[model samples]
Target: MKLLLTSAGVNNKSIHNALTDMLGKPIASCNALCIPTAMYGHPWVGPGVNAWEFISGKSENPMVDLGWKSVGVLELTALPSISRDRWVPLVQETDVLLVSGGDALYLNHWMRQSGLAELLPALQAVYVGMSAGSMVMAPNIGEYFASWTPPGGGDEALGLVDFAIFPHLDHELLPDNTMAAAERWAAGMRGPSYAIDDQTAIKVTGGAVEIVSEGNWRHFTP
Candidate 1:
């Protein structure tokens, strides 16, 4: 399995370079399976247009423009009534799973309810996670926020990887309270944990994990 774990969006040129180096192609060459709706209730949750419009070249999502062929964009809200069978197969078919940033708790809940949790591991696609998408792969979801209330009152994660993933380590961009919450959670974690800055990434391939970037990383174990 290949994992490209990012803190936030691929906004910086340096970060984009690192990502392209890892993927071995320019950003535009890689076919993208974008899941912006996973973060917002719908892709249109942010501005006037929906996620599909943004990804399909109608509008622009800075994150998508950074790289990605924008082959398909899944809107979870419009298809609320549809079964997971209709969606999971689409996710399985992608070459790279580009999970957009969003609320960690809600994303985790939706993934479980939608049956994505069961289907993702079975697929051989490369998983590229940003923010909340990265958090769901960790052992628990509670670490991402200072104080949050899940719709169903649960904070566990999908556990794609054994370690905890701390995203958005840019102190200038994140609130002090949020950073403190993440730090507290990292301090108490039982297994291994990694704190990744916005410019940093943790790449996992062939059972080996490597930090790829010109940024700092801290490892913890309990």
Candidate 2:
């Protein structure tokens, strides 16, 4: 699978171009499945309106709102109860997975529990993760970003990517996530990390990484 990790969604032309390049086609011809499970575990997000907004393309975060050939919802929590035949084929046919922001840990937990994490290694789909969705791909999210705790009680994630991410850098609404705070978060990462603004995105394919930005970003080394 290919990864397009964004602080926000494809908020700028550069990131949008990156997405198009990853898809190797216009988004209008691609099929998408949006995951809204992460929002339910976050205090600031929801099990209600915020989740609905994300799925229904009403959220201002700029993900599902982007035009697609078709869009469907894949709630990770519900995957466990249904047979694989019922949903696995649906996933395999989709061109991309659109993930939302909220609690990274919670998203990670569900990704594992829902069998999605295991399936990811073989999928021929692009993964476009926003905020927590992006962070879940890292080796760890750090304690600073921890919201919901998983049963294992660690800040671990899928570790699909070797580094970590400090998203929404310098976002006005999240004053504490400034560069200074990101620096502190990076120090404990023990690997490469990035502080990216809403306009920035990191693209990873075949283990190579590139920064796609139309705004501010900084690479941090531990």
Candidate 3:
């Protein structure tokens, strides 16, 4: 499996290159399935508003700028009401899975409920995660800015990666995502944890894990 887990989407040349390299092809050749499930629970957006547009600005959506052959939005919350057989094929055909950021627990809940978690491990598509999207790929997410309580009151994440990821350290806008707060949170984690800024990403391909970064990051273990 291959994952390009980022605190923010491809914000710079380094991240863009990292994603392209992981794809093993030109960006224009790939087709992406953008999963905006995490944006569903955002309180900032009122009911009846377009959550994807609110959470993912057109410019910030890397798939659009990367020139993918097609970029389709797959809202995981609507899966239970639809046919899995019909949609599973869309996932199978995509070259990349681009997950947006929001509440980590909410994203995790939907991933399980939508059967996306089970489908992910075997998928040939490269997983591209942004913030909470990246956090949900871990075994668990240590406390940070977002105050999320899982629907089942569970702390477990997808466990796609062995460790927890604490993203957006020292970010400009997110005041709560500070190094002090991250360090404090990481101290309580049961396993290893990584604190990464927006410009950084953790790339994992099978057994190989490497930090592809342009900003500050730190690894913590308890």
Candidate 4:
């Protein structure tokens, strides 16, 4: 599986290039599915608009600006109302799975409920994750969030990757995103963790992991 887990979306040239390299083709020729399910729970605890802007990538959304032929939103929460067979193929056909950031627990719910988790291993599409999207790929979120938990009382993540990601470290606008907070969070983790700013990403391909950074990032264990 190919995955690009980022604190933010493609925010710099290095990340953009990493994405391009993974695609092995012009990004404009690709088809993208932008999942915004995580954003649904933003108001309860988040930066609101700023989170939206980062997820949306505004009018300059790299997928659009870079030339992805088809880009659309897939609300994972709505999966139950639709035919899974029909929707599952759409995921398989995409060149990219653009998962937006928001509440990790919320997003994890839809991923499991929607069967997206099951489909991921076989997916040829590059999995591009932002913030919460990146976090959900781990074994468990535990109290890394400090203020939240899954509604169903589970800390389990998708376990798509061996480690957890703590995003938005040291971001100026989001006061909670600091190195100190990251240190606290990492200290509680049961396994490896990565603390990354907006311009950083963790790329995993065929079991090899690489840190792609145009900004600050560090790996730690608790």
Candidate 5:
């Protein structure tokens, strides 16, 4: 599977170009499945979804533009009540899974409960994770933030990626202490870890990782 874990949105023209090159088509040219509900309570959800609007040139819900045909906007405030069978077709048909930014723990909890943790890796589609979406793939979510309690229980994560990723570093848009917290957390890790600045991303393909962009990328290995 091809995975693009970006620190933020696809706001950089150069990054956008690189991503299109990597994915082999204009982002808008491909059908995208956006999980904007990942950012549930954030103010950015509206704007972030709007950004996808500009990207896809569709004023309607950006999720629709991604070719979902039927966009499922699930409110994961609690344990998922929907059956996994209902999402099977959508997951199978999507060309790209675009998980938006939000509270990492919350997103992680929902993904785990929804059974997407297992379903995503088995799919044929490309996975595009941003911010909180990126964090869920790591083995642990503690490095990214203090703690997040989902409605059902304590929030761990899906553990898709083997390493921890700290996104949105050195970006004024993030909380002032985020970077420091990540640095401290990474310092104690026993496996590979990354602290990616806002403009950067780490693309993992065929078990190899390449840090992409013009910013400081720090790696920690124990």
Candidate 6:
């Protein structure tokens, strides 16, 4: 699967271009699936207006709003009650997956439970992730970003990508997301990590990783 992991959802032209490249076609021609499951697990963004905003394309982030041929919801929590044949083909046929931000561990839990985690590696579609959606691609999000932990417990996520991410760097509302704080967060990580602002994204295709950014980002080596 192609990955376009962003601090915010396609916030800048560079990131948008990267996503286009990953899609290998125009955004208008592609079909997208929006996943809002992560929002419910977050303490601040659970089961209300935030989830509605994301699904309706009215959120501050720009995932579902990106003008696709069609946009559908793929709520992870609801997958268990349904059979795979009904939804698996729907997922495989989609051109991309627009994942929302909220809680990384929580998203990771449902991804695993919903069998999406196992299906991801073989998927032909692009996976675009915003904030915690991007963070869940990492091995672990670290304790600092942990909220709504899994029943088994820990900050561990999908581990789809080799590195970790600390999103929303230096945003006004998140007072603790400064470079210094990011450095502290990086200290506990076992592999490479990145602290990126809203205008930045990390693109991974066929095992090659690249940064597509219009704003600030810092890479830390372990």
Write down the lDDT that model 5 would get.
0.65
Alpha-carbon TM-score of each model against the true structure: 0.77, 0.98, 0.92, 0.90, 0.77, 0.98
How much RMSD separates candidate 6 from the native structure? Answer: 0.7
Give the poorly placed runs of model 2, Cα more than 4 Å off.
none
**Model 6: residues with Cα > 4 Å off, grouped in runs:** none
TM-score of 3: 0.92
Specify the poorest-scoring 10-residue window by lDDT in model 3. 45-54
lDDT of 4 by residue, 1-222 (tens): 699998867878999999999998988789888887776656553446644553455623353345588887787888988898879888888999888777888888889888888989989999998888889999877675624456778677889899988888888878987888888878888899899998899999998999999889889876
lDDT of 5 by residue, 1-222 (tens): 677788775545555655665667655566666675466534555446654553453542222344333344434443267675666677787667777776677777667666666677777677777877787777776633634566765445677778888777777756663657767878776567898886777787767788887776688775
Better candidate number, 1 or 4, judged by lDDT = 4
The candidate, 1 or 3, that scores higher on TM-score is 3
- TM-score of model number 4: 0.90
What's every prediction's RMSD, in angstroms? 3.8, 0.8, 2.0, 2.6, 4.5, 0.7
Once superposed on the true structure, which residue ranges of model 1 sit more than 4 Å away at CA?
11-27, 41-62, 77-80, 83-86, 143-148, 175-182
Residue range 149-221, candidate 6, lDDT tens digits: 5899878888998899999999998999999999999999989999999999999998999999999999999
Which runs in model 5 stand beyond 4 Å of their true positions?
Answer: 41-85, 150-155, 175-181
> What Cα-based lDDT does every candidate model obtain?
0.66, 0.93, 0.81, 0.81, 0.65, 0.93
State the RMSD for candidate 4. Answer: 2.6
**Clashing residue pairs in candidate 6, if any?**
none
Clashes counted in candidate 5 amount to 1
User: 133-162 in candidate 2: lDDT tens per residue?
Assistant: 999999999999997989979999999998
In candidate 6 the C-alpha lDDT for residue 131 amounts to: 93
Count of backbone collisions in candidate 3: 0
Write down the lDDT that model 6 would get. 0.93
